[model samples]
Target: MQKGKIGVSSDNLFPIIKKFLYSDHEIFLREIVSNAVDATQKLKTLASVGEYKGELGDLTIRVSIDKKKKTLTVSDAGVGMTSEEIDKYINQIAFSGANEFVEKYKNDAQAIIGHFGLGFYSSFMVSKKVEVITRSYKDEAEGVKWECDGSPEFELTNVKKERRGTDIIMYIDDDNKEFLEDYRVEELLKKYCKFLPVEIAFGKKKEWKEDKQVDTDEDNIINDTKPAWTKAPADLKDEDYLKFYKQLYPMADDPLFNIHLNVDYPFNLTGILYFPKLKKNIEVQKNKIQLYSNQVFVTDSVEGVVPEFLTLLHGVIDSPDIPLNVSRSYLQSDSNVKKISSHITKKVADRLNEIFKNDRKQFEEKWDDLKIFIEYGMITEEKFYERAEKFVLLKNTEGKYFTLEEYKNIIKDNQTDKDKQLVYLYATDVDAQFTFIEAAKNKGYDVLQMDGQLDSHFINHLESKLKDSRFVRVDGDVVEKLIPKDEKQEMKLSEGDRLDLTPVFHGQLPQRGKANFLVTFEAMSENDSPVLITQNEFMRRMKDMAEMQGGMSFYGDMPDNYNLVINANHPLVMRINEDKEKDLEKDLKGMKSKISTLDKRRAELEKAKEGKKDEEVPSAEKEELHDVSNKLDELKKKKETLLNEYGQKNKLVKQLIDLALLSNNMLKGEDLNKFVKRSIELI
Candidate 1:
């Protein structure tokens, strides 16, 4: 027997290994199993090169858990380490045996997974003690047993062994007894080794006998050895890809389509990227893309490996170039990772364009599901936006689709405004905004359905991309104002009449929760609705953007601003104006005359004092001007009070205001009830 300390600069190595070597102690299983696989693959390489004259029997790795013994063992039938080899590799900390072997057999060795020497020490994270019983393949070699008990001190001695392989036995600590559970071991194997290059057996296969599961004689192998991503795209059919997608995500709906990524040039990257049917809640679908290193599952959080928008996609991405154990910041800053991300973005754009150019009907059929991803890409990645513009589509309220250029051409002749800017009319809800949509269509304009969760941000992106183009909601303004021409019409009511009518409409406005409406007059045809409600495109868009993005919460905090546009030419509005003049004519005329006299005197006093020093102006004149201003304000208040009183008495005024509120989906609860009763009385 020989006793020695592990090669380390400090005596606190074991503590560091247990607490800081790995982010999660569960990864110890992955590290040990991966090492076993490396040994098995090395044995195959040696046999092929005639370096070892032995039978290459079954190379399956076995993992067994013994609850009674409180030990978990991972055994492999492969090239095992001799005493001298163990002394050099195991005793010397941070010395990777796989790295040495690969250096020696660089031409013949297959891909090795371990590059860092710290993987073996990860076993100490969950073990109270660990033992390595190994027998080298060399002729006339004896088996060696190595043991360590949570310390730098280790024991090595000769032992009898029949097989040419290695066995790693971990005596699980009391704190980590869960590792002794069969189901837990099986689950770890299935997660990390499901697609490994070597077959891994956890325990015996089970069978349902008399409604109870029983162990069978067969081995329960948990790995595929060769997944679909490792094969060529030519060998896979569409159904095969879909089958693999189901294997990855059993509960998810069938993906809209897939992109078979098989690139070997810039960096070795292979996987199938499925375009899943994403929901409006983007956070729920994020981190679904699993990233693997040489077929071993590394992580499902692949934010840095792919573009931010492409993270919405679901599938597996296996690449040997990505480091298995590194910070996300390092992965994001690595040049190769950036190249891989760029390549993936390009491939996705290319595939969509191919589908669109070859079979546009199919593309259109899938557009509703595909729009969210494309819009996200366009809003986030500039390169993706440039490539995706050709395939990005806009669907009208009539269920017809068109590309950006195609829609522009169709509407350029009529939708172009007086400033030569083309207006793109869109509606959030076709049914809810049916009146506005019909008005737009009546004016020979098309209205698109911009109802996606990300449409607000996407519209702003398109405005920047499309030249001389602007997007306007169908309910954003009146149909004529949405695409205004050079011709202007005069309002039927004078400014004074309009101001007087403002109080009448304002008095009848409902108490909508956190909503503010401004009464305004527009000259329209008598056939139009007497009153219509519209929102400003910019403010509404800002509020919508604030809902999706940060740093714009101030916009969301503001109340929704709406315009109550009263068409002066409409019969109801004209009648209301006539009624207002008849009811408040006596009181309004008296107040107006008084206010006019006070205003004239104040203006003369101000003109008399112009360009004079403060001392040169008379104090009595200043006091008189102040009185005149106060009297003018009081007369205006009296006029407003009389108009509001008249407006409250007039049932027609409340009916018109309620009609406008109902059109905007804002009339509800007690206000809606009152409006209904008032509407019945008026009828």
Candidate 2:
């Protein structure tokens, strides 16, 4: 195979570099400011190494805007370039002097991010013309002036400069004159350079004077040179972290906890992540984690950099190991990124574990706020789930918290089902599900309050991870069926009696749009409420997940189905049965006999014609069978009408159904008003 060198044409190079060097035009400001930081850091490195024997004056980098001229300038008090140095580095594209300087002074120049060489060209992304005035730190080396427009042409000349630093001035292009506005430039500086190592000054500090704001001589320093994350853990106090958290999120509720990550062995990473008081909207909490490199703010969107669950946290992470330019594919494949992500997950888990072990009470106090983050982590990351299981807490309606294992031990003997699966009963809302919660509590079973936004998904995740343990909402079933240690209680009514009594309770159900009710009879203890409403666990779970996640609209779109369970053994229910028998006993017996006769004949005819095809069956037999089926339907309808008429006059039936519906927070409007009036009349 023949090989040849890839060539880049001079004519296309300038435009390509300006248009595609960075993603956004606003990034030009970040690039120029970062280059200034690199130069300032280089000067500090020289002074430390004894190569530059000169007093290092104030190393502040200043950003200023000239709106009238539509120009932007960044000035730094750091190592400047000589005429030849400018020719070698500036004239050549993608050759940063900071790289060479950092390599030579690698031990002392830890702060140098090594971006100035090529990043300088990024200024052209938003500028029609650019000028560089720089003076060498070496004595008697002449100052140099370099200027370039949007083309591949440049001018260099000798220039008088007093400062031993660089000043990059850009004539803002018409399309990007927004950069010339003082507020816009200041906003960019704060976004990208707020945590930089060197002080960055944007404008004069403003003070309130005579009810108006006026500029003062004091510089408006835009960044905190020594941010909390850059310092050693021993040097920081709790208050220091709190102050940093406030700086990051001014209006957020105080965080539940903070994880200060400082790692250097596998990869350089430093950050302070705070677990904020998360709301129901997970989307709103994301993109709060900021990513940085050597204190230069890179981006607030850190999804690819951190574990997905950790993005829910609010904080800053700075690592030179994580490349300045991060893309999804690059981050997913990069070894350094993988290491950093793993390390951060471990740090978060470790911090949570430490707090739990040292201060149990405090951990419980913050459980509500910390729960969503922990649950989200446990759901998304296997390693995180493994670690979190040790500290993740379960809170009950009694307001007590326990670890998964502890909760299992506390409820095992009472909650283990006939299938030997442990049951974890929970409620979404303490007030809304109060009756069910109390029902479980009355039976000496603990009811967990899983009310957080992600708790629905978290419950599903826990079921998969825990050993044969299932989480059932308190309202998922009656107490006996929820755990099911014993076989289901047989309904007290007979097969015929059950069918005859269905209409008694079913007929009184109020019309609820998109809601379906199935009348069920359960032989519960007389002490229990006569009627109770319960939703099936699996169907409810699908609907809950559909609301939180995508691709499950089938379940969400299905009409709500609830079991209106009639406690057959309850005194009031037995009394309703007695009253129904008194009113419809003669009519029910006559209907039952006729129904049996028709059903028996229908079954006989169906069996006789089973082997015979439809065409072989005689027309007389088909007509006789059809008449029997019609008679069955007519007899059933008459029986139902008789039971319904009896139920209409029975206030107890209405009150019991109303009580069950009200307990579920489902009774409303005219039905509720009628229930109150009927209850008063009965009293």
State each model's C-alpha RMSD to the native. 3.8, 5.2
Please name the candidate that would achieve the greatest TM-score relative to the true structure. 1
Q: Largest lDDT belongs to which candidate?
A: 1
lDDT of 1 by residue, 90-139 (tens): 88763234335324433322232362135677888899999999999889
Q: What is each predicted model's overall lDDT from 0 to 1?
A: 0.85, 0.82
Off by over 4 Å in 1: 94-117, 326-332, 588-631
Colliding residue pairs in candidate 1: none
* True lDDT of residue 109, candidate 2: 30
Report the alpha-carbon TM-score of model 2 versus the true structure: 0.91
